[model samples]
Target: MSHAIAADQREHRRLQLAPTIIRADIEQDGKSREGYLINVSLGGAFLSIADPPAKDTTTTDLHMLLPWGIGECHVQARTVWEQTDDQERAIGAGISFIDLSEDASNQLQSYLDRFKELSIEITS
Candidate 1:
């Protein structure tokens, strides 16, 4: 298959997560709480949180903290999957980042560099 076709079948950058636990701050209903990042793709991310809203929670402000710094991206998220953690904490959320600002997107990309390096190290 062509490279493009293979790439299309995969998510952006095929990011190889490093199992690094990253924190996410999600706010809704006039309240905010912390969540842990499961993994990330170029256009979206999965998070573990308690009692996340239903699917298609559109036009919500999501704050993602990367190693470089904190990034604020507007997102339209949906509840793709949900499950309780070992601690019996409700977790699991999928978010489709949308209309991200150029700068914000750039920051996210830069942060993913760490994952790339980790992937290289493992492969080698």
Candidate 2:
């Protein structure tokens, strides 16, 4: 199954990053699980983990360190979708930011914009 979102359906363009290890603390149902951020956009992100929350899970709290010495960003997210490998192992999930403070949003956008500019320079 393809995980690609249709271009017309996406609200924002996703920025693929180099393999950067960003540790994340995901909270749900009064429990917390560790994961890593894979890719991100202004709207959402893909999180990789050994055990993902149930599909029925609606919301989660995520705390993760931003790259480039940007410090940490926190937001409440809604589980939009999930993916599993053939072995039934949990691979990752797509989470949309449901609640983000203005400061946090600005911080994230700045990081993404910097990354975008760097990518353009590298490609050119």
Candidate 3:
């Protein structure tokens, strides 16, 4: 298979998460905004907030709360894109993880794995 096809299939294989309330603290340029996580995959996550940073805003410090009694995880990410509503209000932004500590990566992978397992069980 071609590389493009494989990449597309990998994107499609990401688990679709429900609207779980995961807290997120995003910091950029010495400013911080608290928000809720919308969805997540191993590559990236969508964060819902009242005021997203500028489109070109790249690096950010992200602190996220894990579900199922798991503790928090901190990682650095780059903002890939931003979204807004019809009213021009800031809705959310998509961020790709760029820097993750070994522990944080393991924690996030564990959480994602559990979520995937639960999802499969529900569908089955």
Question: Who wins the lDDT comparison?
Answer: 3
Model 1: ten consecutive residues of lowest lDDT: 68-77
List the candidate 3 regions with Cα displacement exceeding 4 Å. 1-19, 87-90
TM-score of 1: 0.67
TM-score of each: 0.67, 0.77, 0.76
**Residue 52, candidate 3: how far off, in angstroms?**
1.0
Each prediction's Cα lDDT score?
0.64, 0.75, 0.76
* Residue pairs of candidate 2 with colliding backbone atoms: none
Q: Per-residue alpha-carbon lDDT of model 1 for 2-105, expressed as tens digits?
A: 99866744764465444556777777767777777666765666677767666766654567657644445434454544565556653776666677677776
- Residue-pair clash count for candidate 1: 0
Candidate 3 yields a Cα-based lDDT of 0.76
Candidate 3 lDDT, tens digit per residue, 6-102? 8955773574544355788888899888987766765667777877766656688889889887788998877667887747654888767776788
Worst ten-residue run, lDDT, model 3?
12-21
Better of 1 and 2 by lDDT: 2
Stretches of model 2 off by over 4 angstroms after superposition: 1-8, 13-21, 87-90
Which window of ten consecutive residues has the lowest lDDT sum in model 2? Answer: 8-17
